[model samples]
Target: MALYITDECINCDVCEPECPNGAISQGEEYYRIDPNLCTECVGHFNTSQCVEVCPVDCILPDPDHRETKDQLQRKYLALSGQATAV
Candidate 1:
């Protein structure tokens, strides 16, 4: 599933740069995750880099953008300009 920044975020600025997909950005309040660009780090890392680096433990799965691992893999491939499986 895609991840999102919660209100618990301390605006630590650590999670933004750690996102390989460049999905995280500063919002009106805290950093926000763009589900369209988020691949849960599937193509880049074994785990979510933002979650690892976040100090406040505010990043959590986006229930609204729920996705399976295969879906995430497909997204990663697409974002990397690779062909995805049908």
Candidate 2:
């Protein structure tokens, strides 16, 4: 599943650089994650880096954008330019 930053985010600026997909960005009030670009760090790391570094634990899976592990892998490959998104 894609991850999203919640209202609980403290904007500590830790999660931004941790995102390998560049999916995290500063929003008007807080940071936001672009679901289309978020692969939960599938191909980049064993675990989500943003989640690891987030001080407030505001990052959480997006229930609306549920995806399987294989789907996340495909997205990671596509994002890395190793393959085209199907």
Candidate 3:
């Protein structure tokens, strides 16, 4: 599943640079994750970098965007231009 930032986020900006997929970005008041770009770092890292570096522990799974490992891989491929989003 894609990871998302919660309202509890402090906007410390720690999570942004740690994301391998570049999915994390600054929002109006907090950091946000682009579900279409987030792969939980499957293709780039062994685990979610944002979650690892999140000081506020506000990052959590997006239940609405649940996806399997293979699906996450496909999403990574699609975003990186290895394949198209089908």
lDDT of 3: 0.90
Instruction: For model 2, name the residue pairs that clash.
Output: none
lDDT of 1 by residue, 12-70 (tens): 89999899989999999989999999999998999999999988889999999999999
lDDT tens readout by residue for model 3, 22-72: 888899998899998899999998989888888879999999999999999
Q: Model 2 compared with the native: what TM-score?
A: 0.95
- Evaluate residue 44 in candidate 3 and report its C-alpha lDDT on the 0 to 100 scale: 93
TM-score each candidate.
0.95, 0.95, 0.92
Off by over 4 Å in 2: 84-86
Give a tens-digit lDDT track for model 2, residues 1-86. Answer: 99999999888999999899999999999999999999999999999999999989999999999999999999999889999645
lDDT scores for all predictions? Answer: 0.93, 0.95, 0.90
Give me the runs in candidate 3 sitting further than 4 Å from their true place: 84-86
